[model samples]
Structure formats: structure tokens, C-alpha cells
Target: MPAAGRLLAERHKDHRKRHPLLPAEYEDEQLAVVEVTALWESESASGAVLLEDSELTGYVLGAPKPSPVWGPNLWVEAAGQAVREPEHIRDLYAAAAAKWVDDGRTVQYVVVPDDADLLDAWFRSGFGAQHAHAVRPAPTTRLEPPAGLKVRRALRDDIAVLAELDLVLPKYQSRSPVFSAGELPTLEEALADWEESIDDQDYATFVAEYDGRVIGMSVGCSVEKSSAHSGLARPDNAGFLGYAAVLPEARGHGAGRALGEAVMQWSADTGYTAVVADWRVTNLLASRTWPRLGFQQTFHRLHRAIGY
Candidate 1:
């Protein structure tokens, strides 16, 4: 296994398949994948650090729990790379695996039916099949909320309010940080820069207001994969109801559901045939709400860590 990533680039094909939408800068970001690995190495998430060779030619990433110790994740040198030496690679992951099993820990796994071979390898290696992650389908057509909360297209001025709401919601500390506090666009800033995001097509956000405040929101985007048809080979036509949040005070009043329903209708009316929304495993409200509005529970992406 000699520097195969550069010499036999094709061997890294599995990694590419694992992350198809990986931007050109696959290795960098504020929450860069590289930094995630390094930061969690000793944290709960680092299950075990295995090196293909004692020289550290290849390694694995995993985070063990307790304190959600090192961020639990895994990575290795590109498969075809020179570090693919069987004994070394096995020993490397084996060390981590031993620690994981002995520690009485479990890791979460997300897989597609088509990745049978990969799943086989994973299970054979002791990765248990956790509960399948689920998503909700967007409304197939546009439909209004119960008609009193005032559903309207979001205005430039509303970004601040919505951005404000974004600030107060519970921060789901998952492996991938899609909604960090700093990532939120301020109202005034988002207003001035609204034009920049509009041209992306199939991008729109709706809001529900009561007493002059942006009480609830329903934002949709076409960039995500849908729950109905997941294979990459399938045609892409669905969108995701990216943001559907309601203030706590508005919960039982049906504001959350209204906002969500309105967004599904908007998507359906706007030509999107499907809508998908992601909810953390612990969000009892979302887990229950979407299914009530014909948003069939689809799949989930779990977060786990290793360590005590």
C-alpha cells in the first residue's frame, strides 16, 4: 500500500461514492472534515485510531462516549493506496475495534440497500444495524394552514427575525454541523444579499406571523436528495423542506404544523414533486409532526460517540 491515493486514484472510488456532493474542497471547511477527525481523535467520537503501518501510513477515526468523548468518526488512507497492506490495516482497525467492544460501545451506521457489499463488510466487522433514520415527504401540492396565523411569502425585513429565531433554537450537536450559530445570516445582511440566493432556482422560504413577529417558518430547497427515490441513478425532482420551526409559545396553537404544511404546498405548487425534512433523533415534536401532515416518516442519520 504505497501512497495509492495519488498513484492509483481509482482505488479511492469508494470514498468518492460515500460523499458524492463533497465540494471540490473536500478536506477543508470551518467544520472541515480534516479538523473534525483531528479534533475528535481523543474525544468520545474517536472509536480507535488504527494505523496501517506503525509509521502511520493509514488510520481510522471513531469517537467513544461517556462525555461523547472524542468525536466518534472513522477514516483511513485511500483503499488502493500503498497502506492497504491487509495485516497492517487489520491490526490498525482491530485495535480500535477491540477497544470499542471491550468498552461496551456501539457506533451508528447509515447505509443504502445498494451498498450490500459495504454493509456486509461493516457487519462482519461488528457494526450493528441501528434504527433506520427517517425523513418526511413534503406535501405533494400547495395547501394553506388553518387560515388565521397569516401565511405569507417571507420579506427581506423578516430575515432578521427568522435569523433571530435561528439563534434561540436548541443546537443539535451532531457530527456534521449544518446549522451552527455563526452560520446564520443576520436579517439585514440576508435582506441585502437576498438576490444572490434567489437565482439558484427552487429556493424559497415562507413565514407565519402573529403579532408582527415571524412566529414560524417553512423554507424549501431543491439541492437535497429525496426519500422516495434515493439511488443516485434516479432522476432528481424533489426538494427538502429545509427549515420548519415554531416558537414554543405557538406550539399547541398549530403554528408549527401550519408553517410546515404551507411549505409542502408551496413546494408542490412550485413544481417540486417531493419534500424531505431532517430532524435530530431527539426532537420529539418534529418526529411526530411531519407524519401527521402526510409527511411519511422516511429515514434518519444517527450520531454516536465512543469513550467514557
Candidate 2:
């Protein structure tokens, strides 16, 4: 735990320069130090640190989470190297992963989208790219739907349609090496979530209707800086856009574009300055669409599964 803060300060400064597309997190150093200190002090987490002549050279920390939906219930919460001393990355990551293996954790998750060396280090430890987080400033443009299409807030009657589109993400991920269709929520589950979202003031669900039939859908909700799980975001008011999808027959129209624009405009009008969303790296439709919507790649959520 000692000197970890100092190491993080140097790493954070360099990370910002290398990943200008990511939102600022100047407080990450302090927050990381606090989190690591708490975990270390808890006596429940395991960590590995490489030292050179009694100075911290590199470090990796792991702790168990309450859930393990992604496989290994353990998480590599923090990892970094001192300025200009990246040689120990592989060893450090390996050491931490070894602890997970001993602790019966076969799957490990870590976010290192912007850190190539760190990502390489994790790759050496058996991790691979899983998901991506993207963000952009909320737009003020008043979006217009395609000919004969209309965009509106989804009502209770729209849950069935929205739930179907929600399956699109899982379907896309199911075709990739990093995911399984089983991970996606079932129609019942998706409908339940939509139903609950209706009561949440901070949440919004939008749909594009053509000829009175829902052809596309999008969902967004607010997340404060301190509540963000992705450390790539700045400590500012932000919103998350998700469940965005257009029916196969509706793709050529403007359903996807209109839904996206409306959600972003709603975010802006709701007083949020930035909006964040993510897609699997292999999700071609999302990969191409989000970028054109003005979102920039920010963080990559990488994963590795052992014995599965």
C-alpha cells in the first residue's frame, strides 16, 4: 500500500496524455489510493508489488466482488508501474493472477482500454478484449425521424417491443469469442427491467415508431461522477445510453439515428454535459454507428476465463 499513491499519480498523468479521448480523472490517483488502502487494510484482498532497491516499481491488486457473472468473481481493481519503469508489468500481472488461481477464481476482469502496455501485461496473464466504453458531449440538435417515422418516449405499452430490441445486443455478442448468448437477459427479464425503469425519474426510454409499429429503441439514465464504475469518465454529471437497436428491416431508414439523437438531446436538455455508452469491439453495427454519432472510444473492458 505504501508509495502506491505516488506511483498512481505518475501513471494517471501519463495515461491522460496517451488517451486524450477519455474523460479526465485527475482524482483517480487519490481515489485509487483510498480504494487500495481500504482493500489492503481489509485483509481480504490479495496484491503484488515489485520493488527495486526498496522503491515501488510496479503493482497489481485483486479483490473479490459480490458477483461473478463474467466468470472469475475476483477483480484486478488496480495495477500500474512507476514512470519509465514498465518492465515489471507482465510479472506483476502474473503474480496477481496467480493469487486468483489459488483463491479459486478462474475468471478475472480488468479495464485497460487505454493502456497498451497494461493491456499487454494482462494479455500475458490470459486476458482478452471484451467490451468498450465510449463517450461524447451531449448534443443540442433536435433530431428528426425518417419519413413516416416518429420518435417518442416509450410508454408502458412499449415494453414488449423494447425488450425484443434489447436482445439484439446479446445476439450480437453471442457471435463473438468473448461472450455467450446465455449472458443476455431473457425476454421476461428485459421486460421487467423496462417496467422498473419507468418509475425511475432519471431514466428515459425512447422508441421510433413507423406506421404505429416500434422499429427502434434506446434507453438512457443518469450517473453521477462518484457513482461511475468506469474510471475513464471525468467527475462530472453524465448519462449512459444503452439498449440501442434498430430492427433489421428498419436499418436503412433513420430509426437508429433518430433514436440516438433524441436520447442525446434529452440528456443535454436534462442538464447532463456528457454521455457514455459501450459496445462490444466486435459489434460491427454499434462500432460503426456510435462513432458516427460523435462518440469517442474511451475504455475497454477486457476479460479472461480459465477452465471454461
**Best model number under TM-score:** 2
RMSD of candidate 2 to the true fold?
3.2
Q: 58 in model 1: Cα distance from truth in Å?
A: 24
Q: In order, how many clashes per candidate?
A: 44, 1
Tens digits of lDDT, candidate 2, 228-291: 3444344257777766888777787778878888888888889888777777776777877888
lDDT of 2 at 295: 82
The total number of steric clashes, by the backbone 3 Å criterion, in model 1 comes to: 44
Residues 1-308, model 1: lDDT tens digits: 22222322322333335433322232222223333345344455443333434544444445433333323333221111122332343444566666655656544333322234433444544444432223334454447667567788777667666665554344432223333222444556644555455344556777887766678777776635334233321224556666677766666767888877776777677676555555544456766786677654332232333443
Q: For model 1, give the 10-residue run with minimal summed lDDT.
A: 75-84
Against the hidden reference, what TM-scores do the models get?
0.52, 0.83
Off by over 4 Å in 1: 1-72, 75-142, 171-202, 225-235
Q: Please report, in order, the local distance difference test score of every candidate based on alpha carbons.
A: 0.48, 0.70
